[model samples]
Target: MPARERNHPLRLLTGALASSRPWTFLRSSQIGHRIRHSLSAKLAVAITLAALVLLLVFGIIVASQLRSSMFETRKDAILADASLRFSSAQSVFSSSTATSPDQVQESARGALASLKASAAGAGATNVALLRSEGSTASLRINQIEDEQMRGLITPQMREAVAQGGAQWQSVGIRASDSDKVSPGILVGTQVQLPRAGTHELYILYSLAADQRQVDVVLRVLVLSALPIIVTLPIGVFALLHRLLLPVRLTVSAATKAAEGDLDVRVEVHGADEMAALGRAFNAMTSSLQDTISRYDELAKLQQRFVSDVSHELRTPLTTIRMAEDIVWDNREDLPAHARRSAELLHDQTERMEQMLADLLEISRYDAASALLDAEERDLRPIVTRVVEACAELAQRQGVPVEVVAPARAAAEIDERRIERVIRNLVVNAIEHADGTRVTITVATSATDVACRVRDRGVGMTQEVADHVFDRFYRADTARARTTGGTGLGLAIATEDVAIHGGRLQAYGEPGKGASFLMTLPKHAGDEIASWPLALWEDE
Candidate 1:
C-alpha cells in the first residue's frame, strides 16, 4: 500500500485513543530503565503546558472579578438612585393622615404616580406595592398594568419588606404585554399607611446593561491573555533548546564511546558545571584507553617470550631426553643410589618436555596461528584411545578409569585436536581423582557430539570451576605441579575446542568431584546457542 493510503492521522489517532495508546506510556514505565519519553522533553512540555493552564485560570479569575465588580457597582448605583424615589413614595403613603378607606386608596394612587415620576425606566423596571393589612389584600404596581405582574411580589419579598429594611434579589421577570424574558432585580422596603397597615413597596430593575458591561470587560481580559499564553510555550521551547545542548552532546559522546570509539570527545563550550562534567567524561575515556593499551602490550610481550623460549629449548630438551634414556638403560650397572637418580632424571625430563609442548601450543593460540583441520570423523575410537593412554597414569595414581562410548559418534572436527582434548581431560581427572573411579562418557545427539569426563575425587568448588580453564589456574595448586600437571592442559584444550567451534565447560561441587564436558557441532559451520548436554549431571 502507498504510505498516504496506509496512514491517516485522524484514523490512526482515533484508533489509538480508542484502544492502546494511553496504556503504551504505562507499558514503557513498566520496563524499568527503558522510558519512552526523555526526561527533559517530558519536563519541558509539562512545565510549559502548566504555565499556560495557570495563565488561563488567572485570566478567568480576573474576568470573574471584573464581572462581579461591575455587577455590584451597577447594583449599588441603581439601588441608591431608586431608593431616593421610593422614599417619597413611602412618605406619601405611610405618613398620610387619611383615616377613610377611600382616602387611603387615593393616597396609595398618588404615591404610585409620584414613584413613576421619580425613578422607573428601560434601565430600571416595575415598582409594586403589596397591601399586607386591609380587608382587601390586593397588590398594586405603578408602571405595570398586568395584575399577574402586580402579584409578582412573592411572600418572601413581602416578608423581607416587613423586616423594615430594603433588600434586593435577582429574578426572572416577564413583561405581561410581551413574552421577552429579562434578568431583573427587585428591591423591597416596608411602608406603613394610617388606614392600610404593613404595605411593601418593591422596585424592580433589569440587569441587561450591567451584564453587557461585564461581558465587554471579560472579552478584553481574554484577548489580552492570549498573546502571553501563546508566547510562553515558544519561550519555553527556546529556553529548553538552549539549556539542553550540552546534555545532548554529552549523550552523543557517550554513545560513541560505548560503540568503542574511545577518541570521541564532546566539545566544551562554557565554564559551567556541565562543561566540567564533559571534561571529566573525557578524562575517564582517556584513562580507560590507556589501561587497555597497557594490558594488550603486556599480553603480546608475554606470548612472544613464551613462543621464543619454547622454540629455543626444544633442541636442548631433545638432547636431554636422549641422555636420560641412555642413563636409564645403564642404571643397573651403577650403584643403587645412582640408579634411583637416573630414574628421577628420566621422569623430570619427560615432565619438562610435556610442559614445553603445552607452552608452545598456548603461545600459538595467543599469536592466532593455530588453525583447525576439521574433518568428519567418529569419536568413539578417539575416546577409547585416550582412556587407554591415560590408563597407566590412572593406575599409578591408584584410580580406576572407565570409558563409555557408542559404536560410533561422528562429527566434523580435527581428530587430533579432539584426541588431545580427551587426553587432557582424562589425565587431569586422574591427577585429581585421588584413587577414585574416573569415567569417560562419549555420546552423540542429532545436532552435536559430546564427551564428558567425570571423577569422584576431591571435587572443586563452583568458584574454582569458573576459572579452572585459565592458564596455570589450579584448584589444588600444591599437588598439581608435583603430580606432573602442566596447568595449561585444560586451558590449551579449551582453546583447541573453541577453534573447532565447540564448547568445553567445567562443573563441580565442593567434595562432590568435577565434570568436564566437551560438545561439538555435527557440522563445522553450525553454531550452538544452547548445549546439547547439561553442564552438570543431576546428583
Candidate 2:
C-alpha cells in the first residue's frame, strides 16, 4: 500500500481516540445528581446500620443483666423459705418433751409430709427427708427410701446435724426411676429425746419454681424486643424518604436549567445545602441566558455589516467597468499619453473587478453558500498547467520555472477552486521570485495528494508570514506596487483550500526563499491522511 493509505487508518484511529476521551470534569447537573441520589441513600444506610448495632449491644446487656438478677432473687427467696421451715420444725419438735420415740418419729414424718405438700403447691418438685446416719430406716419413712435420699443429702447435712439443731444445706437430688434431677435446699436439725439418743431431721425444698420464673422472664424479653427490632428499619426508611424528596426536586430543576430552560428555578423551602444548591443553579442559568442573548445580537450586527458592504460596492464597480470599456474602445484614436492613460485605467479597473470577485467569494464562504463540485482527478496535471500559464511572466523576469511531477498524484476535489489555488500560488511565486528559480512539485499517496510551490524570491520574515493570508496584506508596500497584483490572491486561495477541507501553509525566512504547500484529501469529505510536504528540510 502507498504511504498515504497506510497513514489513513492511523489518522482515523487517532481522531477516534481523541473524540472518545472522557471529559476532565463532570458537568454541574451531573455532579448534583450524583450527590442527590447517592449521598442521601448512603447516609441513611449508614445511620440505620449504626442504630442496629447500638440497639443490639444494649439489648444484649439488658437481657443478660435482667436474667442474672431475676435468677439471684429467686435463689434468695427459695433459701429463705427453706430456712423458715427448718427453724419451725426444730422449735416444734424440741418443745415436745412428753412424746414417745415412735410418736415423735410419726410426728416428725407428718411435719415433713406437710412441708412437701406446701412446696409442691409452690411449683417445687422432689421434696424429701434424710436421717443424719445416712439411713431412712431409722425414721421409718414410707414415701421414699434411703437409696432415694442418698443423692439429696451431702456432707454438709452431717455437719449441720453435728453442730446443733436448726441448720440448713442445699443439694441436687436424683429420684428412683427418674433420669432427671432437681436442685433443692436441704434443711437438717438435731432432735434430742429420752429413749432415742439423737435423731437428725431433714427437709428438702426444690428450686423448680425459681427455674419456672426465669423461663417467664426470658419469654417476656423476647416478646418485648421483637417490636423494637421490627420498627427500627421502618423508622429509618421513613426519615430518609422525607429528607431525600427535596434533593430529588433540586436535581429535577437543575436538569431543566441545563436543557436551556433558563427560567426554571427550584423552590427552596429550608435552610439546607440542597436549598443553597438550588439558588446557585438558578443564578448561573440566568447569567448564561443573558450572555447568549447579547452574543446573538452582536452576531446579527456583524452579518448586517457584511450585507451592507456587498450591496454598496456592486453598483459603483459596475459603473466604473462600463466607463473603462468606453475608454478602451476609443484608445487607438487618442494621443500617446492618452492611450497609455486609458490602458492603465483599464488594467486598474480589471484589478478592481478581480478584488470585488474575491470579496464576494469570501462572503459566500463565510455564509456557507460555497458548494463543492468534487471529483477524482490527478493533481499533478493541474499544477503543471498552472505553472505553464505563468511561464511567460517567469521568462520576462529571467526567473527559472521548474516542474516536478510524481508518477501518480490523484485526489477528489472541486476542480475549479483547486485550479484557482494552483494559479494563485504560481502567480504569487512569479511576482516575488526577484529573477530567481521557481519550483512546483506534486506528489501523491493512497489517501491524499500534495503540491508545493517554492520560489527563491524576496522572501518574507516571520512577521509577514503570520499575516500572509490576510486580505490586502503585502510583505513590502513598494514590492506590492511593482507587481500590480491584487492582494486578495493568497487570501482567496486560502479560503478555497479550506472549503475543500485541505490545508494551505506558507514557510519562509528573511532573505531565504519561500515554500507554499497544499495538502488535500484523496476522497471528498474525507480527512487529510499524509502531509507529503515537510515544513523544513536539510536542503
Candidate 3:
C-alpha cells in the first residue's frame, strides 16, 4: 500500500483522539475560563460541541442497528435453505425401493451429488456428507478433494448426531492443502433404513460467497455513511457560523465601545437575533454618545458663566476692600454704632469675595479647564506656613494650633495651589475648633508625602462627612454661621489636590472631631505610589 493509504486509518483515529482530549480537559479548565472571559466564544463553542456530539451518537446508534439487522437476516436465510434441503432429502430416501447397502449408499451419494452440483453452480463451495454409524464419508464433487473432505466430522456434528435431531451450526473448514481456513454452515440429520441400521446424514455449505456479499454490503454502508457523517457536521458548523457571525461582530463592537471607542458599530443584516442585538447595541451607543456630547456642551457653558461672574465681581471686590481700609483707618472718629457697623461691613465684604473666588475655582475644576504649573517642593514648609497664617485667628478664637513634622517631605505639585489648599483647610479647622486645639501633622514615605489637619471639635456625622467635600454642602446650618464659610472651601481644596494627581480624604466621627489628610506623589509626573498617613494612629 502507498504511505497515504497505510496512514489513513491512523490519521482518522488520531484526529478523533485529538478532538476528545480538549473536551476532557475543557470542562474543568478551558470551558470555564472561556465562559468567565468571553461569553460569545463560550456560547459558540458550546453549541458546536453539542451539535457534533448529538450527531455522532445518533449516527453510531443507527449504523450499529443497521449492521446487526443485516447480519441477522443473512444468517436466518442460510439456516432456512439448509433446513429445506434436509427435509427434501429425507423424504426421497424414505420412499426408496429395497436394495443392497452399497447401492443404497451410492443412490444416496448420487442424489446428494446432484444437489451439490446445482448449489455449486449457484456459487456455493465445500459441499460434503458424513455417515453416522461409521467413519464413511463422501464428497459431493471431486472439486472438494481429500484434504477438504476429511475434517467434516467435527465436535458440533458429533453432538448433533448424538442428540438425534436436525441441527444447524457454523464451523471452520480447511478448503485446500494451504494454511487458509474457510468458514461454512453444517446441517445434520438422523436417518434409519431397513437392514442398513441407522446413519447420520450431513451437508456442509461454505460461506465464502455469502461472506463476499456481506463484505460488499459493509463497503456500501461505509461509503454512504462516511460522507454523510463527515459532511453533516461541516454543513451544520458552516450554517451556525454564518448565522452567528453578526452576533460575534456585534459583541466585538460592544467590547470596543466599552473600551471607549464610541464609533464602533456592526453592519445590519437580515432580521435575526444577531441583527436585533446589533440594533440594540447601536441604539445604546448612540444615546451614550449624545448624552456625553450634551454634558460637554453644558460644561463649556458653565465654565463661561463662572469666568464672567469672577471677572465681574473682582473689580467691585477690589473697590470694596480699598473703601473698607480707608474707613477702618478712621473708625475711632465715628460713633460707637457706626464703628461697629463699618467693621461688620468690612468683614462681610471680605468673606463674600473669598466665597466668589472659591466658587470660580470649583467651577473651573469641574469644567476640567484649569491648568497647573507643577514642580517638586517640600510639603513641610507649606504646612508650617498655613499654621503660622492661622495662628493669630486660632488664638483669638481660643483654639491652640500645633504642628508636627517628622522629616522634610517633598511632593510634586503646584506650589500656589498646595499653599491655598493648606490655608483653606487650616482656616476651616480653626473656625470649627469650638475652643479645642487643632494639630497639623506632615509625614513622608518613599513614594508619597502627606499632611493631616485634625481638630478636636464637635465632629460631623457619617452622612455629613460623606458630602463634606461637595460644593456649598454644610454639616450643620447653625454651625455654618459661626464658621463664616462660603461652603466651597473643601470642594476647591479637593480639586486643587486632584489637579496635582493627589488624593484628599476626610475621617471623622460624631463628638470625636475630624481629620483631613492630603496625600500626593513624591516625584514630579509620577503617580502616588504610597500612603504615608495611617487610618488609625495614636495622637
Candidate 4:
C-alpha cells in the first residue's frame, strides 16, 4: 500500500486493531493492576461498605422500636376496652330479669354478642365464650365467632384467666378465607353469670394494620437510604480526589526527580500542610540538583588531572627508557653491583610505563571515550590463548592450569578487550592459587557465551571480593608484588565488559576458592538470560 493510502482513517483503524490483537491480555492485566493499585478506588469501596453496614443497623433499630411502640399502644387500648365491656357484661349476666337456666343461657349469649358489636370498629376482632368447671351443664354456654381464633386460647392462658386476673398472649391469626396468617393478641378473663356459672371470655385482635403501617415506614426508610447510599460514595470520592490532588502532584514530581529530572518541582498552592510538603520537596530537589552539579564538576576535573598527569609522565618515561636501555646494554663492563642496579632500573622503568598506560586507559573509561571494536569470532581460541600466556606464571607459582571448552564458542565481541579480561583473570588466579589448581571453562548458550576461571587457593573474604575490581585495590599487597601487577587489571576488565553490555562477576569464600565468571551476548545489545556454566559449583 502507498503511504498516503495507508494513512486513511479506516485503514489506520484496521491496522491498529491488528497490531493490538496480541496485546489484549496485556491490556486487561494493566487495567486490573490499576484497579488494584488505585488508592481512591480502594478508599471509596471501603467507605461505601462501611456506610451500608451502618445504614443497615440503623434501619433495624428504627423498625424494631416502631414495631414495639405500636404493639404497646394497641395493648393499652385493648385492655381498656376489655375492662369496660367486661363490667357491662357482668351486670347483664347478674340481672334479676333472667332467673331460669334457659334465660341465663340466653342472656350469656346476648351479652357476648353485644360485646363483639361494641368493639366492632376498633379492629379485626374475634369473640369466644366457654363454660368453665362448676358451671351448670344445661345453662353452660360455649360460643365462638371464629373457630381458628378459639383454638388460639391456649391452656396456659385459660388457667391464668381462671385465677382471677385478665391475661393476654400474642398469637398468630389465620383468616378463614385464606391460608395467610398475621400477628394478633388474645385477651382472656373470667365472666360470672347469675343462675348460670363462671365462663371464660376471650377477645382476639388482629395487628395486620400495625404491621402494614410499619411496612410503609420501612419502605420509606429504604427508599430514602437508597439515594444516600448511591450519592455518599460519590461525594466521598470527589472529596478524596480533591484532597489528594496535591499528593498526586508531589508523587509525580518525585517520580520525575527519581528518573534524573532534578529540576522537576511540585506546585504549591496554599498555606496548608500539603503546600508545606510541596515546598519542602521543591527545596530538597533543588539542593540535590546543586549537589549533583558540584559532583559532576569535581569528576570532570579529576578525569582531566589523571589524563594530564599520564600524558606528562609519558615524555619523561620515554626519556628514562631510552637512557636505561643504553645502561642495560653495556652493564657487562661494570662491576657486579653496578650491573645489578642497571637491571633493577630497567625493570622499574618498564613497570612504570605499564602503569602509565593503565592510567591512560582508565581515564578514557572515566571520560566515556572508550570505543568497542566488536566482531563475530570464536571464543575458544581466545580462552586458550589467555591460558597459554599465563602458563609460565602458573608453573612458577606451583599451580596447575587447565582449560575446559567445547570445540567452538562464538559471540560478537571486542576480541582484544575480551583477551585482556581473560588474561587478567588467569594471571590473578595463578598468583593466588597457593599451589592449587586453576581451571578455565568456556561454554555457550543459544544467546550467550561465557568463560569462568576457578582457583582452588587462598580465597578472599566477602569484603575483599566486593572491592576486587576497584582500582589499586588488593586483597593482600604481597600478592601484587609476587606478580608485578599494577592493581588496575581487574578494574579495566570490569570497564571492558561493561562497555560490551556484558557481566563480569567475582565470587569468593574465606579459605575455600575464588571464581570469576564473564558472560557476553552472542548478538550486540541482546540480553543474556542464562549462563552456560555455574560461577560457583558446590564441592
Using lDDT, give the best candidate's number.
Answer: 4
> What residue runs in model 3 are displaced by over 4 Å at the alpha carbon?
1-51, 78-291, 363-375, 391-404, 426-439, 454-468, 475-481, 507-515, 535-539
Ranking of all candidate structures by their TM-score, best first: 4, 1, 3, 2
Residue 369 lDDT (model 2): 82
lDDT tens readout by residue for model 1, 1-539: 00011111111111111232211234444443432345455555678678766865775566556655665576677678767766777667667887777777777777766775567553656666665533253333233234544555666655555655677766666656898455566677767666456666677777765555555665665567668766765677678767878888888889999999989887887899889988998899999889989999999999899999999999999999888889999999989999989989988898898899999999989999998788899998888788777767777889988777854779999988899998888888887778888888877777888889998888888899889999888776456433566779889899988988889999887777889999998888578644656767755
Candidate 3 Cα deviation (angstroms), residue 515: 4.4
Please identify which of the two predictions, 2 or 4, would achieve the higher lDDT against the true structure.
4
Candidate 2 Cα RMSD after full superposition onto the native fold (Å): 19.4
The 0-to-1 C-alpha lDDT of every candidate, in the order given, reads: 0.73, 0.68, 0.70, 0.80
In candidate 3, what are the lDDT values of residues 200-239, reduced to their tens digit?
6666667565555545654554456557655655566576
* Separate clash counts for every candidate: 1, 0, 1, 0
Error of 2 at 80 (Å): 42
Which TM-score value belongs to model 2? 0.48
Badly placed stretches (over 4 Å) of model 4 are 1-54, 96-109, 131-147, 175-181, 193-196, 476-480
* Runs with alpha carbons beyond 4 Å of true place in candidate 1: 1-40, 60-68, 71-75, 78-82, 85-89, 92-162, 169-187, 191-196, 199-220, 281-284, 393-409, 430-446, 454-458, 476-482
Candidate 3 global TM-score: 0.64
What value does the lDDT take at residue 197 in candidate 1? 62
User: For model 2, how does the per-residue alpha-carbon lDDT over 1-539 read when each residue is reduced to its tens digit?
Assistant: 00011111111111122232322434598755764667554675577668657755765566556545654565456556656665665566566563465676576666667766766554445444444454443334333235546665567556646666455454555555786554455555665433344556555566555544544655565557567656765676677778877777777877887787877777777778867877777788788889988988887677567656866888998998898899999999999999999999998888777766776777777677888998888887787787788778778788888888857887778888999999988888887888888888888777778888888877888788889999778878765444466677788889888877888998886567888999988877678878877754435
- C-alpha RMSD of candidate 4: 14.7
Clashes of 1: 1
